[model samples]
Target: MKILIADDDPSSILYLQDMLGEWGYEVEVAVDGNAAAEILRRSDGPLLAILDSMMPGMDGIDVCRGIRQSDTERYVYMIILTSRVESEFIVAAMNAGADDFISKPFNDEEMRVRVRAGRRIVELGEQLRRRASRDALTNIYNRGAIIEILEKELSRQGRSQHAVSILFCDVDNFKAINDTHGHLAGDEVLRVLARRMAATLRPYDSFGRYGGEEMLGVFPDCGLEGALEVAERMRAAVAEAPVKTEFGDIDVTVSIGLATVDKDQTCKLATLLQRADDALYRAKANGKNCITIAH
Candidate 1:
């Protein structure tokens, strides 16, 4: 495991480095709290941090607070090393997001055990996040997950000035199909449509079920014209493919709406979705099985 040691005492920092290194861990040291915080902010970071309670320019508690505040995937197992063992001091460390605690003049075996336990907690947290963010039916992102991803992508693209497009699609006459063929058939159709859309799009492009019989797609680095082409292809594919059921072959068509992100446009995912939805209504108005572009 990779470990970070942050302590104002040079001797303590050296002791940690030597012990952890002998235990087959890669160790990085920070002399004070500010340096530790900077190291945590980097793209590559340590799996755990052993922070001293007293440090200059920001205490270990403040450093822990900052780490918890950032949205980073690398789990920081913070162990606060301090002489203070009062109830209030322990509570304060916990409140500041300390994962574990070690008294000053730490026992080597105890420290190792605590770090191992912290790793388990980090794994559980990751698993829970994945389960919460995924769609149960399609296994693609649900509306909430898609919106979160959209917001992040928008923020990233804003800084980079990259192009991105949104495609809103609906199964044409889906209600009629469900009423005629049964809900089971409707479900199969939705699953098949999702799979087909995923196959057609690039690996980086995101697809999700926006709601019942509706799907949302995000194509990064794609302009309006390219998005329209993609939407047209998807619409044609759906029209051509016939879903087979116990009843018989059921043909389906899809209506699509395309919108591109720009500097002037609102960055909010909901606003982008609304624009795409408006375009989808226009598509339905113009014709049932066609693509419409939103300006």
Candidate 2:
């Protein structure tokens, strides 16, 4: 785990850094509020922070306020280092989004306990976020989370006028599978297809379960040709394998609708998604296991 110590006092910095390091933590340092705030607000910043209450400017309270107000999805657990014991001071710290507090000149044992508590809370928060963002069945991004990712990626690509490709995929004969084998078996097929198709995708591509037996893929900086190639690979990955379930080996295949936004083409997110969906519907109409591209 990483901990950030934001204090202008050299002695305090050295003391915390040395102690935290001894306790198996990587320590990051910032001498002033601006630097501290920048680190804490960054997406990959340390989630555990200890801020001195009386820094030169924009003290710990201000830092907490700024972080809480920022549009970052990362959660930061902040502890305000203060000597004050007044009720008003505690209220102020809590209102500013400090998770906990440690009095200045704190006892060594007290610091260790409080730090561990903060780390546990951070871990719990992360677990909760993962549960909320992931699909319960397939362990892929849930519908809302996947759509959010696609929007963010598209917005990022739009800024650079880079190509963005997407795929809308659905299981072929999924209803028939559920009627013949149990729904549990159908679920197993979905899981198996998700795992295989995900393995075949490029590292940067995003694959998620949009809904039952339907999946969505977002490919940033990938063109139409690349997207179609991936679609074909995904199709083959499912058609070539039999998913082993409690019932038995079950044959499965998928149909895909591939769409792309060229650097020169500008379109709304809904339009692109609908284009892919339309293509996917056409692919299913033409044949069960096939890929179709949207012009």
Candidate 3:
């Protein structure tokens, strides 16, 4: 894990850097509190931070306050390093969102133990986040996470003016599959189909279970033709192979509805999703196991 050290004290910074380095942690140093806050704001930056209680521009408490207010995807575990371990100061730090605190003239063994605990907490938070964002049965992204991905892709497309497309795929006669076999058998079908559909998509493409037996796919930089091609490929991948389940081998197919956002279209994430959903309904109306492009 990457650790951010924010302090104005040169001697303390050097000693702590060497100690943490020896402990096998990647270190990022900030001479002032403002710099440390900026690093924390980055999406791909460090998840663990140590901030000096009194630094130029911003203090450790101030940085902790900013971190707590920010809407970051991942949780950041923060420790406030203070020379004075007064009761009021400790209370203030905790109120400002410091997860832990370390006193100055810190003992080497104590620092190691505190940091070790912080690392465990950070890792556990990430594990919970993954579980929350993933589908329990298929182990793919869940509806909320996929919708967030779509929104993120839409924002990226807005900046780059690159084509972005989405597909709404529904398992054809899914309820019937559950009725004919059992819910367990239906679950097996969904699991097998999720793996197969994922195989058909590019590594960069985003695929997720959008609740029930419907899946959503996002294709970045893909126009109408490319989206249609990928959709057809996924359709055929499922139809060509029977999903082997513990219950039995079950034939399954999907109807796909594709929506593309070109440079000319001013669309929101919800708009794109609705268009794809409408197209999916049309595909089912015409026939199952086919692809329909939203006009």
Candidate 4:
């Protein structure tokens, strides 16, 4: 993990930089609080930051407050560095969203422990984020994450005008499977199909569990023709093999509905999703196991 050191004092920056480097951390340096704030706002920036309390502009507390106001999805653990360890100052820094604090002329041992703790906290936050975004049953992205992915794709398409496609997939006769075997067996079938179909996707493509017995696939920079090929592979993945569960072996087939936004067109996320869903309805109406495209 990378750590950012933001301070104006040359001697203080050099001392802290050397100390942190010795502890095996990749260090990023900023001469002013404004520079530090820019780095902290980046999505790929370091998770841990040490800010000087009295930088010339945009002081440590102000920077921390600024970062807290941005997206709270991916957390940045911030520590305020100050020469004074007064109770009043510490209280003010904590209120501004500083995760930890270190006083100037700081003890080397204390700094080491705090840095270690900061990394652990950042990792824990990431784990919690993953847990919240993933579906509990199939281990794919949950419904909310799928919608988020769709929105992001639409935004990117508007900028680049590159082709994007989506697939709406539903398991055929899923409720019948539950009635015949058991709910546990049906769950196993969903998990198996999710893993199988996901294995066939390109590196940039994403597959998610949209809801019960339904899945969504997002394809970036892919046209209708390319998406059709990918959708066929996903359909075959489910039909080729029987899912083995505690109850029994069950045969499964998946129906896919594909929608594409060509490179020349820009559309809303809702419109794209609605087209795919309508195509899915057509696929179901045509036959149980098949693929249909929304023109």
Most TM-score-accurate candidate: 2
For residues 92-186, write the lDDT of model 4, one tens digit per residue: 88998999999877899999999899999999999999899999999999999988988888888999999999999999999999999999999
Candidate 2 yields a Cα-based lDDT of 0.91
The TM-score measured for candidate 1 stands at: 0.64
Where does model 3 exceed 4 Å of error? Answer: 8-18, 21-31, 54-57, 148-164, 198-206, 219-241, 268-270, 285-290
- Give a tens-digit lDDT track for model 3, residues 1-295: 9999999889988998999999999999999989999999997789999898999998999999998998778889999888888899999999989999999878899999999999999999999999999999998899999999899889988988999999999999999999988999999999989988888888779899998999999999899988888898899989998888777889999999999999766698888999999999999998899999897
- The runs of at least 3 residues in candidate 4 whose Cα sits more than 4 Å from the true structure, single-residue gaps closed, are 5-39, 52-59, 84-92, 155-163, 199-205, 220-233, 285-290
Off by over 4 Å in 1: 1-59, 69-77, 81-91, 103-109, 148-164, 172-181, 195-206, 218-254, 264-271, 282-291
Query: How does residue 97 of candidate 1 score in lDDT?
Result: 90
Reference-based lDDT, residue 242, model 3: 88
On the 0 to 100 scale, the lDDT of residue 216 in model 3 is 98
C-alpha TM-score for every candidate: 0.64, 0.83, 0.78, 0.77
Pairs that collide in candidate 3 are none
lDDT of 1 by residue, 79-186 (tens): 899999899999999998998899977788999888778777766876777778777777777888787777888887788877789989999999999999999888
> How far is 113's C-alpha from truth in model 3 (Å)?
1.2
Q: Which residue pairs in model 2 clash with each other?
A: none
Decide which is better by TM-score, 2 or 4. 2
Give, for candidate 3, the lowest lDDT window spanning 10 residues.
Answer: 263-272
